[model samples]
Target: MTRLVVVGAGITGLAAAFEWRRRRPDDEIVVVEAGDRIGGKLDRIRLAGTWYDTGPEALLGRVPEAVGLVEALGWGDRLVAPATTQASVVLPEGRFPLPAGTVLGVPASADGLDGVLTPTGVARVRAEVELPPLSLPDGDVAVGGLLRERLGDEVVDRLVEPLLGGVYAGRADELSLAATMPALAAQVRGAGSVLEAAAAARDAGSRSRFDADGPVFVTVDAGIGALPAALVEAARAEVRLRTPAHGLRRTAGGFEVSVGTAAAPEVLTADAVILTAPATKAARLLGEVAPRAVDPLRGIPYASMAVVAIAFPVQDVPAGSGLLVPPVTGRLVKGVTVSSAKWPHLAGGEALLVRSSVGRFGDESQLQRSDEELAADVVADVAELLGLSRPEPLETRVARWGGGLPQYLVGHPERVAAARAAVGEVPGLAVAGAAYEGVGVPACIRDAHRAVDALA
Candidate 1:
C-alpha cells in the first residue's frame, strides 16, 4: 500500500485526504496540522449558550465542489439555505437595498441604482454605453482602474469597493480584473462597453443552474464549523495536531518530510505528498525540491482581519439581513451580518447574533486594538448604522485572523500557473490552498482534487 502525507489539515488538506480515499481506499494517509485543531479558519465559539461560527458562515451553493462533498458525506439532508439574502449598503444618506442586475456592484443598466448612487453618478454610468467601445488590454489590469475610467469614481467607491471589500478585504484599485471577476472581465474584452459587458454577464448568470429564484449560499444545521470534524471522521486519516512540517526533501523512494519542533524533530517518509499549507509555509517546504515554485508562492501577499461576534436581544436589533460599509465612509467596521436573520437555524432564539468584520489589506492597526476595544467600536458602529439605541450585547467574542485572505493582484493567475508548472516537474509533489486559486471553500476543494489528480 502507498503512504501519503498531507500537510496542514485545513479544509483544503482535509478535502484532499477525502478525495484521495475515494480514489485509493487502500492508501495510508496521515494529516499533519500546525494548529491544535483540525479546522483552520472554519471555527466556532459559544455565544449566548449557542454555537456561532467565527469565520466563514456559509459557502456558495452554486459551486458544485462543496455542495457535492456535503452530499457525498451523507449530510445532504442537513443542508440549509439562508432565510434571507436581501442585504443592504450603508450610504451617507441612509441604508438602501443592494441594487439588482449588477455583477459585483457593477450596474448592468443603471436603472435601479438611484438611491445607491448620486444623480451625477447614475448619469456617469448611463453615459458609459454612449462612450467609445471598450476592451481589456493584452495583460491583467486593476479592477478599479479600468472601471473608474469608464464608469467614474462613484461607481467604484460606492458600489464596487464595498462589495469587493466584503469578499477580498482588499481595495478594488489593487485587485485584478482577470482574477477577481473573471466572467465580467471576459465579457469586457468582447463587449462594446463596460455596461454592456455587465449586462451580458448578468444575462449569463440568470441562465445558470443556480440562478436568482434558487438559493445561492448554503450551510449546515450544525454550522459550517462542524464540517472539519465530519470530514475527519469520513476521511479516517491518521491526524497529527500541532505537528508542523518544517522541511521537505526528495528521497530515492519518494519524499521525506521533517516535522515537529526544531530542537526535537521527526521525519515521515511517504510515497506522495500534498501541500495545503499557506503560501509562505508552502514556499519554505518546496525550497529544496521545487525551487522554481518558491518565488511565486512567496509572492502572494495576505490581509489580516478580525471577526467580532455579538449577541443581543432580538427586539433590540434592526430588521435586515446585513449591511456592507464602503471604505469611503471611513468606518472601522467593514461589514455586518445579522446571523439570526440570515440563517434559519439561528432564528427564533432569544439572542440575535450579529458579526462584524474589521480591517483591510493595508490597514492592520484595527486588528492591533484590544479585543474589548475592537468589540466596543464595532458595536457602536452597528448601533449607529442601524439606528439602534446604545444597547449592550448579551455576549461577545472576537476572532482575529492574521493574514487570513490572499490578495489576487494583477497577474495572479500567471503566478499560480508558474508555481504549479514548477511543482509538477517533481514526481510526487503538489500544492493547493486559498493562496493559489479562489479563496472560497468550494474553490479550495476543487483545487485539492486537482492536486490529488496530478499525483494520480
Candidate 2:
C-alpha cells in the first residue's frame, strides 16, 4: 500500500486526506495536525449555553465544493442557508445598506443606493456603466487598482475595503483580484462590463447554486465544524492531532515528512506529500525541494484576525440579520453577524447568538488585543449599529486566528503558477487551500480535490 503523509489538518489538509481515501480505499494515509484537535481554522465553541462557530461561520454561495462534500459525507440533511438579503455597510459618515446586485464592491444594482454613496459618489458609480472596464489578460492586478479604474476611490474606501477585509482580511490595494475573485475579473476581461455580467449571472439559474432559493449558502445543522468532524469520522480515525511537522525532505520514491516541534523530529515517509498549512509554513517545509515555489508561496500574505461571540436572550436582541462595518467607518471590527438569525438552530430556544469579526490586513493592535478588550469593542460596535443600548452579553467567547486570510497580492496568479511549476520539480507533491485559488469553504474543497487528483 502506498503511504501518503499530509501536513496540517486544516480543512484543505483534511479534505486532501478524505479525497485520498476515496480514490484508494486500501492506501495508507496519515494526517498530522499541529493542533490538539482536528479542524485547524474551523472551530466550534459553546458560550452561554449555545454553540457558536468561532472560525469561518458562513461562506458565500459562489462556491459549491463545500456543500457537495457535506452531502457526500452522508450529511445531506445538515444544510442551512441565509434567509434575508439585509446587510448594513458602514461608511465614514455612518453605516448604511449594501446595495443589492453590486458585483463585488461596484454597484450592480444601484438604482437607489444614495444612502451608501453621496450624490457625487452616485455619479461616480453611474459613470462605471458609461465607461469601459480596464481589461487585462488572464493575470493578477490589485483589487484596488481595478476598483479605482472602474469605480472610484470613494467606493473602494467606503465599501470594498471593509467588505473584502471582513472576508479576506486583506487591503484592497494589495489583494489580488484574479486569485480572490476570478469570475468578477473574467467579466471585465470578457464582456468589458460588470453590469452586463451581473445581469447575465442574475439571469442564470446556476447563480444560486449555493443558496436556499436557487442554492443559498448553507452550513451543517450541527455547525460548520460538523463538516470537518464528518470528514474525520469518514476517515475512520486516520488523523493524528497535535503533531506539527518540523521539516520535509524529497526522496526518490516519496518524501520524508519530519513531525514534532522538538529536536530530532519523528520522520515519516510517504509516496506523496500534500502540504495545506498556511502559505509561510508550507513554503518553509518545502523550501529545499522546491525553492522557486517557496518565495511566491511565502509571498502570499495573511492577516491575524479574532472573533468575539456573544449570547443574548432571543426576544431581547435587536431585530436585524447582520451588519457589515467598512474600514472607512474608522472602526476596529469588520462585521457582525446575527448568528441566531442566519442559522437559528445554532442557538434556539430562549437565547440568541451574535458573532463579531474584528481585525484584518494591517490592524495589528485590534487583532492582538486581549479577549476582554476585543469583546468590549465588538459589543460596542454591534450595539451602536443595531440600535441596542446597554447590551450586555450573557457569555463572552473569543477566538484569535494568527495570520488568518491570505493576502493575494497583484501578482498572485503568477505566484501560484510559479509555485505549481516549482512543485512540478518534485513528483508526488501538491498544494491545497484557500491561499492557492479560493478563500471560501467551497473553494478550499475544490482545491483539495485538484490536489488529490494530482497525487493519484
TM-score of each: 0.97, 0.92
lDDT of 1 by residue, 1-456 (tens): 999899999899999999999899999999999889988899988887787899889888886888899999999998899988888998887788998778999988879989989999999999998888985679899999999999999999989999889888999999998889988987888999999899898788767744356478998887778889988888889999989999999999999999998887999999999999999899999999999999998888999999999887776455568999998888999899999999998998888889999989999987888989888989888777766664577888899888989999988988899999999999988999998878888889999999999997
Tell me the deviation in Å of residue 300 in model 2: 1.2
**Best-performing candidate as measured by lDDT:** 1
Going through the candidates in order, what is the number of backbone clashes in each? 0, 10
Task: Name the runs in model 1 displaced over 4 angstroms.
Answer: 210-213, 316-318
Position 27, candidate 2: lDDT: 85
Runs off by more than 4 Å, candidate 2: 60-62, 132-139, 191-213, 316-319
Task: Give model 1 RMSD, 1 decimal.
Answer: 1.4
Where is model 1 poorest over a 10-residue stretch in terms of lDDT? 205-214
With candidate 2 superimposed using the best TM-score fit, by how many Å does residue 244's alpha carbon deviate from the native?
1.9
State the number of backbone clashes in model 2.
Answer: 10
- Among all windows of ten consecutive residues in candidate 2, which has the lowest summed lDDT? 205-214
**Tens digit of per-residue lDDT, candidate 2, span 1-456:** 898888878898888888888889888889998888888778888666655688887755545677668777987776776655477776767767677666566566457668788887778877777885546655567878877876678778877787788778888888887776665665656665655655554545354454545445666666787567878777653787778987888777778898976864688989998888888888998777888988888788788888888776555444456887877677777888887776757545666678888877777777666788778888877777666644766777888888778887888899889998888777899888888887878788888899998878
